[model samples]
Target: MTGGRLSHLAPDAVLTAARRVMARCDELARVTADEGAITRVYLSPEHARVNRLAAEWMREVGLTTRQDAAGNQLGLLPAADRDAPVLMLGSHLDTVIDAGRFDGIVGVLMAIEVVRLLRVADGDGWRSPFPFGIEVAAFSDEEGTRFGKALLGSSAVAGDWDDAWWELEDSDGTSLREAYREFGLDPGRIGEAARRPDQLVGYLEAHIEQGPELDRRGESLAVVSSIASARRFQLVVEGEARHAGGTPYDMRRDALLGASEAALAVERICSGEHHIIGTVGQLEAFPGAVNVVPGEARFSLDLRGEFDGERDRVWNAISRELDAIMGRRHLRWRAREVHSAAAVFCAPLLQDVVRAGIRATVAGAEPATLFSPAGHDGMSIGALTDVGMLFLRNPDGISHHPAESVAGGDVALGIRALAEAVAHRGAERG
Candidate 1:
């Protein structure tokens, strides 16, 4: 990317701006990642401190600063036309439990870079060519790891806000309302969080490729096609408790067997062709004794697929496994759903723009698509307005962990792609 395609600014200038922002954000993310619980991260001071810094930077960029009732950080880069729909570029700032730095970080920072490029091309002035304004939003709590609600801020902005989230609590039992009041945001104003139905021209987000596909294919960019639906359940299995030394192996029904069988069923349910998978990421057993048979067992099941029909088919298969395992083990069990997300299709128009941008950086960028097993703010917004996303090649396809990484060159290429997309969109709508 020599900036030949943009013709408005040098690649070095565009990349320098993005890298500078990333460096600063990396520090804040390190601090946020210090917390352990998913939902607990947003309730911690780490989130507050980061919010303050984001506001400060927003002011520095000459955008009007204001916090929504939901405490969504809004930095308004007003275009010449105030009456038409505005374009929003951003993603969530909150991370999952023990998360990595770049998941939502790239989207927020790249948005700022997009603004800088738009300003540069709008004639190196504080002006925009498009009639619609641009605002970079750092959605307050897109990762509802704490509140059991994901896409919090973006949902509100998309007019998909849910009142059910107000009752959410952390492990210690602290409610989201309590945390909100402490941060000076009144929880009662939650309704004010809604963005006008026609307020946004479209939305865009950039996130890490938390899977092996992009790296495996040797591609630096992924124009997301759809976000997979997710279905999760909590499984509890029970078996007879007996003395380990006295109880014969044949006489004792093992709870762990039920759990193990369930785990295998998840994998067997869906073949890799449909991108379906079920995982038992957490588990527990009760009673302390070297000789005693386990009395209780519990685990969590996470399932996802690229399409609804496929996901349903997989879930049915999982149910069949559970029945066989429980009956064979003579164990009483219960399974309860924890959460679910329907698959989301990214806007093709936005995907084409992102493809053009990526084409400017790397070869082999087909106008193709991949399904995201993981959820994102883009999923919620895509349902309401035209939305698209870009993915950076993750070094190990790792995320939600500190060791997660992506190459700097790939990051620079992602930035170039975003710049190209923003310019293209601006041109189309202008």
Candidate 2:
């Protein structure tokens, strides 16, 4: 019952499934808030539309579909034993502002395709079932695009919903609770989305590498080693504003100059460390007039690493450097912690299954292994179940932008590997 012996997974069938996934991604891309760009957010009209479309596709493949109270779309195919715990596969469906088509969309569609392939593989036409049930979840708010807090949907599913989040608002100033009501979901019933430990086997997700490692090595797929530990901050620098022309260079305390130095320090320190990344994604200076020196400056820092201690160490180093820069410039600076998540390592059993699945595709080649720096719904779902991920090659590793791309051929191989992984997992359970 190894993945290699799954005779029904022929090349033509896998390619057809891949093409369908690509087409479905295109279809989902159109159901967005912006007409010209993809911008679907949580609990919006676009969310409802995509859920309906996903449900329709789920039903077509003989799955029992439902939208949970947290607005996640779910579909289930039962096991031979009706009461058995289920193995789940899926990723988020929501998109960031002007997002690429396949960040989370492909995983959901690929999960559906896997189910279809499984049904075809089962010669008895649903009579012969696997040892565990299978479920695909299209989580509603992984991007946190509207609310500014990521993993809202998966956190609810993981039973980690925070009451404080109810007060969180979008750019339009609409609170989460109000949006929930508007989306036809009762805010109080969101707890129903949570799943207890005994009711599941594990979770599996497939996503684009979102980095150049795979594409650089000429590899089509890889097994993820772990998701990185991350910390985000909003940093502010303060100084006295003065007339740019009137003030002498020695007397001027320029906050913008201090902030720029700090940004450069982040890159310098992080570049010297292995697997540690630092990004200054946003920056702004106040009273932005050409003749006036900036009185204050604000910037964001997103720092991540393979381990928590190393990440914090880099942050501490960056902080020291920032202090030196501000002191030398006669300015003051501060940082506010906005978000944090611990590293999540993949389960060994799941990793083995994924490796076997990849072997089924490439025959003799060893699957490349990588650690993901990008955050995902799995970071939240890991609280509920063991999580494993497979990475598809993304050209140039571009993601979260209009230019993100994945090849149809690579997607075809991803489908076969994912289906084989499910089969291998089933055999293990038996």
Candidate 3:
């Protein structure tokens, strides 16, 4: 990592920058809806606060900052020429309910730190010999906590905005269009946020591993190979309601019991399959009374895999299991797919760059290559440009909760690795 691999910035200075990034993540974690927890959602007041803070940090790094029509805060360090190609680095800023501090916010802060390091390498000047400009974006809504549709900000940047999204509503009955108007953004002008593929090079993101892989491997960082494709389903089990005392064990058709068996079956089936994960994250029983035999059971099934076909294969297997259980239990069942996303493979060239960056930053450390099971803004941006990702180890593999964390030294290494990746891409392009 020495001998100019990181320019004039010494190890101590990098660590200092990393500390600042962590500090800022903590700061943003407080700007949430709930006083006792972090709950910032898309287009909320907290979202606006965080964007302004991020924009200020970008300006401190000598980048010109602005918030796009989609409310994504952007910092652009223009190239030597106004029309030169650009490289993008960022992650989303929004969070799920009671979210952790490091899930998406760490990546945005790390991107800003990369710009600061690059500015140092250029003799405290904003210009660098790297041909392409660097743009850091703090995407506003990747979590989809508000409208139930993910990647709103990045989808707009990728020119994939759907008009149908305007009708989407939140729990409080606020339509997406109404939210946009309330937030001072015109729904019709969302298209302005789109970026032409021809205008850029690629997108790179550094995020927490959000899984146990890196922690198990004893590594601080890893290069992402691909993002898992996912499918969501609403499964309903139907049976006649009867008094718990009146229903005899042999004659009863219990929907809740069938659903419980189905859930266990899903877990058992997915357990033996490599890289396939299935979960019944939400389950509900009708009547909700302790004395009543449930008449209906509803549950949500989320299935994910590194590849789309494989994920679907697992789904088919689960469906058969459900059918068999329902048939044996004399219960009727319904399955409705609510959402699905195809797998996104990281570009091979970009992955190589990321690996090279890790080597340059970590000295003798070997970068583990892993696939991400969680969705990210990259899924949308991948449609318009090549996308590469770096995963920082999460010691506990806990995210979307308050216990999410990252090591300070790990953040330092992540910043160096990301900056080196940018440099690597610049040289490759030349």
Candidate 4:
């Protein structure tokens, strides 16, 4: 049997199964240190516990399982075709601080439940086309909580690294080196985590929408077309600080004025591009006092878009505005780029499977192709493998806080759609 012979699970069945699995996962997800919500943030100690539990779950479902050096937990059903490729369904379990319960929790467990139904024949005699083998993964450390980095584990799996990668640390000053030692993982073996490009036919990640598109329309699954690249910059304005009472407005070279003008320029540029967004998230001034003029003023810039050209356009426009502001104010200013990443789109081949699965689950459900305003762990994996993502509807159209949500039915829909896509890849391998 090949990997593409997917006996797609019914949407309702996957939903019911997901609810059960989520309950168990939530128990394991509880934080002892901060007993707040049930969000799954990856901890070195908790990771070992989850890895062991996942292996047991694999055994219960009759699949072979193990953990890799990078702490990724994988459950596999050996392909009938000994040399056949693998179909992967996964998502990170970690979450943002004080996050909602469903963010990344459902995605990982949903994969497990879907694969379980396939191996067991769903009691309705609906067996997957490739019942001989299917796999689920609970990848480690996508959130990069212990360290300030994001998507660390996935980057290592893609075989891209630099000396700077190991230099990352958390707010408490725990470096990646210290994290590895504390977690019982080897920093030296990080390079060994890369997978053979040929071995993985495709990767599918089911994630929360973290936006209101789905809930607003009452839909369940969103087939994401592209992942936006976020270009980061910092603008610094240098001005002469003087006594507020003595310094005349006409004689002042004000950095705050430059900062405000640059901010307006960024706002104006956003009007031209629908997907482009720029934010001045942070601002700081030195020698601050009630009566003193700010000597040095600096602010952070965050810009993002679906294409590299669009990202560049917004950045250039912002720079143009900054230059104008500095010239007008007679103030010296500098712009520095903090980080840059190229935008990437998902595999259309797998996206087709996602659409089909959604349609099969929801009667008259219009499966829409939406672009993610933010990036995901899957985008990082795009460096090494063909990957696609499914977004479950978010109730509030917001995320990274306690307000995120998803309807039970919608979450179930995403799970079914993801399994269908994974099964399609398995069938293709055959």
Candidate 5:
């Protein structure tokens, strides 16, 4: 573990910022739809509550704040020249059902603290002195928990919002457009959230590593190399349904059995490949009954890799394997791609600054670099501007659950590293 104070920051101030971040995370955790767990989804009352709270915090720190038409909460710190292009910092505020408190919330809070740290004290008030303006965004949706479509909020910001998304519905049968109106936002005005490239510099986000890489190595932070490319599919296996008691073992075309074999093949093949991950997170059989052999089975496939070509290649392999399994079982199968996103590599300049930031905070060792396997808002934001990320160590790499954790000390280090990175970027622009 590295042990050293930031050369230019006061230890007490850093610690105080870290504490404030953690305390705010705790505060946000309580604003959830689920009574016993944290589950703040998009366009819900919980979302509105958090946005209001975030706006209040932004004002307390001297930022001009607004909720974008897409429902993303935004706050801006002006540069000496108010018209300067802005450097943006942000992460999603929405969470998966039963999510950990730190995943997205930590990043948004850390960005706020970074702004607080960068302000220079004037006679009666503080002022921003950076070469460019700074903006912090709390994206409304990233997990797709309610709409079943991830990155809706960021997609709007990146000018990629699809009109078809308005037809998407949640578990309660409420359409996205109706929900937007219910949440007091105009769906027609979502375009207002789009940010032009000329109005921005780049995006930087600090998040707790959703995996255990940092914690396993006894390190507190790492520079993110890239967000993984991903492809997702819904697969269906079809066969003739028959009475379970009457169907002979040798004559039966069992869809469930074939689907199970395909699932195992997915795990086996993906495990043999490097940086390629495949998950069958959802599966179901039609006419699920004890007395009937399942006539159809459907499952989801989420495939990801560090590179697009390799990920697609692995998917081809998995498809071939599925064909073999279905053929052997005398069943028919088909697949529909539900989602795909190319990998977003961090800009070299941003990576360099992140490394410098880590170097300044950690003592006597070079900073570690890791590619993120999980998807992030950066994946969408990359379409609009260059994106970079810093990861704080999460114990046991557990995320999307109640057990996700980050140490206060690591957060202190993260805030310092982020502030230093922003300062480094400012110097470069100057």
Candidate 6:
């Protein structure tokens, strides 16, 4: 549905535009490492192809496009003045293994659509009427599937670059430094991608809900309250190995069993907290054989919550449970935090703007507000500017998997909300 102010662009027109955006996302999904599945890692050939396609679309909408030093695809719609403050809109382009088409791709495509709408009205005074420059960025990596650290692209832009990251290697043994060179990007020039906080007016990202909240509420779109704080750990459980048939139940010190209990403790502890989530996304037992008792177990822990203190509290409870389980089983455990990021709150002013956009698109309904449990490029961008997010409904709330989906009507409404947000913000600034 189109807002009254934009009724000149009818529902059919918005639906047609949504179809174009979805079609572009599907086309780019074909650029993947696996022949039968989607897997576009950072700095891979697939990454380059998708970036090129996005850049072309950006140019078609009157943006001056380029690949930043860190390999982020950027398209700029220059303001009347060269030094005007900037407003950025975007999401990452990379995907996890067997990922769905809409997860990150939808944000980037919808950003392009927003710019397209603005460009189409440039002749009608939208060009000279804005006080800030608009940029559409398609970040190269957010999943961090290849290097095990997320937000490489946005982190660089936030000026959080680390020299040690060059040493990170992919599953195929290609170093991050080597990949940069192969992609024709100089590692030393990464700093060129950084932006000063004063240069940005704000940042807005439109993305799929990636959860069931919006669908359950029967709403097409919602404004994000905050991005969840998260911590990840690599846990190793040590125990004794024995022949499965020869070891008595009382004498066995099965690492796998201890790990199983620890994983359960994580769930039990987290389930008691509000808006907290814990996941054992990966687990492996050593000497994976049927006849051998597990001597060692390694697993990954991903803990998240709406607030930092609450998340840490749950983590502590889980750790205490693990210690007790290890002691009872005559086992030892070790944990190392692989990654941690603080929660980011949406700026109140930006949230208000997004709410107005949603209200306008839906004809004055009070928009639902929710916190994002999944990480996004906004987590990094938040370090540089006030950040806000708009989440479109994903019918099943399933993400990462191939079944993740978005309805066409939802996409149309999302585009309208985003475009209206830009207009609303511009009018306020004017």
Instruction: Write down the RMSD of all candidates, one decimal each.
Output: 3.0, 1.8, 2.0, 3.8, 2.5, 2.2
Task: Report the C-alpha lDDT of model 2 over 1-430, residue by residue, as the tens digit.
Answer: 4433476667999999999999999999999889899999999999999999999998888788999989999998888776888889999899999999999999999999999888633443341157788999999988888988889999999999999999999999999999999999999998999999888889999999989999999999999999999999999999989999999999998889999999999999999999999999899998888999999999999999999999999999999999899999999999999889999998888888888889888776799999999998989989988899999999999999999999999999999999888888888853
Q: Write the per-residue lDDT of candidate 6 for residues 207-301, one digit (tens) a residue.
A: 99989999898889999999999999999999988899999999999999999999988888888889999999999998889999999999999
lDDT of 1 by residue, 32-120 (tens): 53444232256467667767777777666666667787767878777776577777878777887777777787778777767766662
Q: Please report, as a residue range, the 10-residue window in candidate 6 with the lowest summed lDDT.
A: 1-10
Tell me the lDDT of model 1 at 156. Answer: 75
- Per-residue error (Å), model 6, residue 31: 1.2
Looking at model 3, which ten-residue stretch has the lowest summed lDDT?
A: 1-10
Ranking by lDDT: 5, 2, 3, 6, 1, 4
The residue-by-residue lDDT of candidate 3 on 202-258, one tens digit each, is 999999999888898888999999998988889999997889998898888899999
User: What is the TM-score of each predicted model, taking all chains together?
Assistant: 0.91, 0.96, 0.96, 0.86, 0.96, 0.96
Q: Where does candidate 2 stray beyond 4 Å?
A: 1-4, 120-128
Q: Pick the winner on TM-score between candidates 1 and 2.
A: 2
25-101, model 4: which lDDT tens digit per residue? 55655742356764444446666776777678766766677776677887776554546666677776666666665
Q: Residue 105: error of model 1 in Å? A: 0.9
In model 4, the number of clashes is 13
Q: What are the per-residue Cα lDDT tens digits for candidate 5 across 1-430?
A: 1122235578899999999999999999999988999999999999999999999988788788999999999999888777998999989889999999999899999999988888776456555667688999999998888988899999999999999999999998999999999999999998999999988889999999989999989999999999999998999999989999999999898899999999999999999999999999999998899899999999999999999999999999998998899888999999999789999999988898888888887886788999999999999999999999999999999999999999999999999999888888877752
State residue 273's C-alpha deviation in candidate 3, in Å.
Answer: 0.7
Clashes of each: 3, 0, 0, 13, 1, 0
The TM-score that candidate 4 achieves is 0.86
How close to the true structure is residue 153 of candidate 5, measured as C-alpha lDDT? 91
Cα deviation at 418, candidate 5, in Å, is 0.4
